[model samples]
Target: MKQDTPTPLQEADDSGFAVRVTQSAKSVAAKVLPVSSGATALLFGVVMFLVTFGMVMVFAASSVDSVRSEQNILSVVFRQGLFTFFGIPLMLIAARVKEGFYRRVAVWGVLLGIALQCLVFTPLGDEYGGNRNWIRFGDFVSIQPSEFVKLALAVWIGFVLSRKGGRVREFIPAWIPVAPVAILAIGLVMLGRDFGTVVIMVALVFGAMFIAGVKIRHLLAPLIVVSVVAVPIVLSSPSRVRRIQHFFDGCTEAEYYAGCWQQLHGTWAMSGGGVLGVGLGNSRAKWNWLPEADSDYIFAIIAEELGMIGAITVLLLYAVMTYAFIRIIREAQSPFTKIVTGAVMVWIVGQAFVNIAVVLGLLPVLGVPLPLVSAGGSQTLATLLAIGVVLALARSDRQSSQDGEAPEDVRLAVRAEGRA
Candidate 1:
């Protein structure tokens, strides 16, 4: 063996062979491990990009309306930008807070939301588009308080359900603690006559419970009860009933000039964009043809000006964002982090889908603004704050991982993959 010692050429070949094997093993491992480690950075990047993209889209969609109504073409964009400024800092602050701090204050947050929502019934409350949900802070300034309630409900539900812990499998144990407060939140929003928000709030409650591992039967019971109660409420309103009736008509002539006006125009906007949009700021809908161009139906304008590709890109971004939230949920070590992150995922992303479906006539118009992309300060601020909470959860989860106590789910996943 000593006499047959390998030459430099043999040594080089052996080293290269080891390198090839290592690379091959890594490739195989990469294929086996489909999920990333929480992907916190990806979540933040997607959110920031959406916020910036929303400002740009709002500018494009609101230019005509701003010039027509405000006499200043930049007025709407400037207002939204100001909200962006305010929301970003709140988001950063939220990201720095401890998760346990939110848990301890959930009840107070719900009370605050309820108090603000009560203002909708006060003298300062102003009616807009038939929904008496706005409170004016000044002659030109107003806010929709239900927007804040959306996040508050999520936090409260998580705190209450997580308190149940091992007993969460029992319906009464989980349902009784949060039921009264949940009812009060829903009732206050109902008093404002904003059914769109009511639907979202209902979903938000169920989402928190579901994510916290509450009994499914308990979750389903309330969902069914709410649906049953909502039917007559929908049919009782003549305007809502008309919208429902026209929803199935496919925007025909008889209904087009009446209830389906926005529906038809929104459809036309999407069709005009084709595979690639007409080009940014080139949408005809913003010229007064499609209503709520910068709010509920902004998705239509995005499709119209940017085309199908643009629409797909927006959807892909959301999909990625959703995945990141799910990853956080899976990697989270504490019940609070998992519950809050899941609740936020449902709030912002679920609302976006509903808004898009309404614009495309796939669903009856719900009047909910597109999250992050809509030109409303309240929705934008609340949503950014929610994301901040999510980032906070992510920070904690990452720190926990670095300390070698990986979340149980993640550790199990790694162990299983390693065996392969």
Candidate 2:
């Protein structure tokens, strides 16, 4: 016996609604993001290339110091190689991690890092180069908690802003808890008298806040207030006050030697490079003429060795990397990815510029490392790990591509931005 056919209206009144809803949900789930493996490959290649170049330059710049200290030409190079060996693989592992996993782990990661920073007060922390920020497990291994603090602060700010939503700007003292935490962190470093790391952390906080949509008025208020308050901090330190004096006075008098020595030599090194540079690994500055040749003054060494063309090329590469990162943050599907990548980009490039500016005598020295190019293991690893997170975001982005339609939530959010 044949059953009677159901009418369109009957079906609509029955299972049509449920069926359509199920199909739509499935469709939305299918189109999570547009992941691009090719972009990931490109990013990895570029990062590795830059890192390798830095390793080579580290050897070139540190050779003289190494020979004088240890009589081993490979001393600094081997140490840098060790950092690369460990850091590169960790970066790769971080790149494969999922977004949700990162979010979940951020709080714990930051908390652990903060705990480590507190250890600076203990006997484990070693004072070096006038900064007591270094924590030594042994003579062979040491970690700079400030390096990890950068990531911690970025993650913490991203989390706080993400949770607070639009009310992040309001003065509820909801951010009050973070104040003590930040003070403790900054205070500990300041106790060590490591102004460079403090500057970096300051930049990282401001960068994260800006990208996470903190109001410009809100940001500028504290910044101005801080500047006003900081006048005493700068004046209180004899070394810092003297450096500032020399910066304005110009490096003319021989008596300014102690204060202006690094800047003066750095400028001479850069000037000596002229156009085509002396040659890679042929820097006269690295021959003990410039202090911190492989660290703060590496750029001057590059200018001396590679000349204007090389210096400009390195600058342009950094510019390209910055542009790429900005593109990644802008195109990111989630606020978490956007804020994280933006913070890291600012930290790396901003620090690089600060280091360069100090060497060029355009700014007072803060002793920040030149990101991937610097000789510090902690900084090299931290920077690479941060970039790797960006690569993971890029990977996840390319994976969610499906049909032409995206989720209603994504579509709605994009529209909201326009309206806002």
Candidate 3:
């Protein structure tokens, strides 16, 4: 009787019908799309291109320095290559971490960063170039904890200012904690005698506060205070004072070379690069004329070897990356995402511009790197890691927006769509 109720053909047809319905439901579930495609794709492409370009330049710029020092032409290139290899994978992993997790971690993150900074005062600290900010692990490996501190402090400020739904105006409840923490962080870095990094950290804090909706008046008072104090610090040191005095001196003046040796050499390196550049790896300044050719002054080397075209190319890449990151902040589902991305963008772009301008004689030398382009292991890896976090935020924001949900509140939602 049961067998007679339905034939084999009818049963097979019923199974096919069920399969179609299930697939149709899945199709409807997956229909949502991101609000903006330009932000994600364009930014991703630009950053990826810049990283690759940086890797190429690292090989070119560091090769000579390597051969001259270690007698191995590939020594620096090999190390850079290794870091790039690790950095790429690390970036991919960071891109997958939850945005909420990044937000929550800011609390402990800042604390850890401060602790690491304190380590510099301990025996673990190593002095280099008159700055005791570096942490030496061995002959060839070490980390600059101050570099990581910049990112952690930025995130913390963003989180703090954005707390209670972006109400950063309350002086006692809000600004009190942030200002003291920031001052402490800055004071620690200044103790290392790295005014450049301290300036960068201050910039990051201000940028975060700005994005968190803090009033200009509130932020400016501290900025003015820091500047007034920094002037005396700069004046107290003979070399730093001379460097400052000579920066204002005319480029034609004799004191320019004697007093501003690094800046002058950097300018010469850039000017030597005409329309098309001397050629990759052919920098005349790398012959020890331009100091720190591979680090703070890499942009000058780039201009010297690649010309105006190459220099613009690098800047354009940065512009594209910055634009993409800004879009991410705009489309972000929450203030936290916006502030974090903004802080990072300002740090990377701001530092790059300062470094380039200094080399061009438009600004005083700040002793900062060109982000991912500069040939420092800890710096390059840390930068790539931060970029990865940005990418993660972008991806998470895209997903949340498509679902018509807040980035922090998004979760699985299921609904049945039935059709006859």
Candidate 4:
């Protein structure tokens, strides 16, 4: 017997009306967003805002130092501005890149990164504050290979993991390829004695693993290994030891004259601004009272110049950016794109919090620049490029949807049994 065919029309009632309204709204969304196309725009806005705000803050924070070093106040800001100019275009170009292009370069990029890191131990290496993480090309140009390596390693990990399918849950085929490479990549960074960057890289790896469906129990081994290796490195330098020992000193007047100098001053600069801030360009700490005013502790200046309100605003911008990243991760069709985008989000957002924690004295001072806000050309360029990859992923979803097809995403389905 043939069952009665269900009619498309619903009987008139409150629930039926709700269903109609929902369907109508969905149809409208399909015509407009088409799989949340707004994510790319949101990503673009947040990146632009952060970069612009960073440029302004860099000018404000560095003007004092620039004048003391060079006759012109705009000297440092101009240099940074030039880089920002270049980075913005690079970011836009990245947004136009295809996912397959990223995949093709993933392995080579990491190999190049590893080769670059080796330069830091060569004749061209430069050391500042105790970490030898930079290489110089004459007096005019310097680069931190670790920054680029961080991005490269993340991309390579994502590429490998995405190809693993259900084997990602297994110890040998999935993790052997990823874990050893990560360790080697991080091991190179460790040779520079830059533990801060290593921490961020670790978070990047962990985030990629989670997105690839690795189990929590499998992560413990790497964490334990990294911690064992990190402790000795942290103690190898007395400056790092002192920074760790007196990190919670609260910058007492006595301590301020000693190891707590930067943290103490950062605290005062932040607290002095209170709710509204001391007003932009009017910070007392910018007058050589605070070290690294424009680099690692730039957040202190943001709080001092713009106030708690301004600091919170910067955090809100980051929060919005992370939201867009989440949307891309959820919607992107390709596993490689999904993995890479998720890793980028983890690195950027996690690094931001770790940086802020240092400023607030909740954690020991580690020389980590605030993402786009800090003064470092190599760091800025590398980070902006990574963000560009995210924008590309954000667009990938819409592009796929407009084609009116579903992605096989067989890797996800193949791994479901492992997830169980």
lDDT tens digits, residue span 1-420, model 1: 468889999999999999999999988854442222437767877888999999999999999999999999999989999999999889878887776688778899989999999998999999987789999988978998999998888887776666555566677777886788888988888877788888888877788788888877878888898889899888877888888888876678677688888999999999999998899999998999999999999999999999999899989999999998888888777666788788888888889888888887888888999888889999999999998888876776666768877544344435544664
Q: TM-score winner among the candidates?
A: 4
User: Tens-digit lDDT track for model 4 on 147-247?
Assistant: 99989987898878876777777767667778878888888888888988988999999998888888777888877887887888889888888888797
TM-score of each: 0.86, 0.85, 0.85, 0.87
Query: Scored by CA lDDT, what does every candidate get?
Result: 0.84, 0.77, 0.77, 0.84
- Model 2, span 1-420: residue lDDT tens: 999999989987779779989999867643432224444444556677779989988998999999998999899989999999999888877777776667778778878887888888799998888788889998699989888888877766665565555555665533555556666777677778888888877777778778877778877877787678668877888988888888788776485457777888888899999999898888888888788999889888888898898788778878877877777776666566667777887888899889888888888888889988879989998888887777776665544434344423245445655665
**Mind giving the per-residue lDDT tens digits that candidate 3 earns over 355-392?**
78878888777788888887777777877777777777
**What lDDT is reached at residue 382 by model 2?**
87
lDDT score for residue 80 of model 2: 90
Span of ten consecutive residues with least summed lDDT in model 2? 29-38
Give Cα distance to truth, residue 54, candidate 2, Å: 0.5
Supply every candidate's count of residue pairs whose N, Cα or C atoms clash at under 3 angstroms.
3, 11, 0, 1
TM-score of 3: 0.85
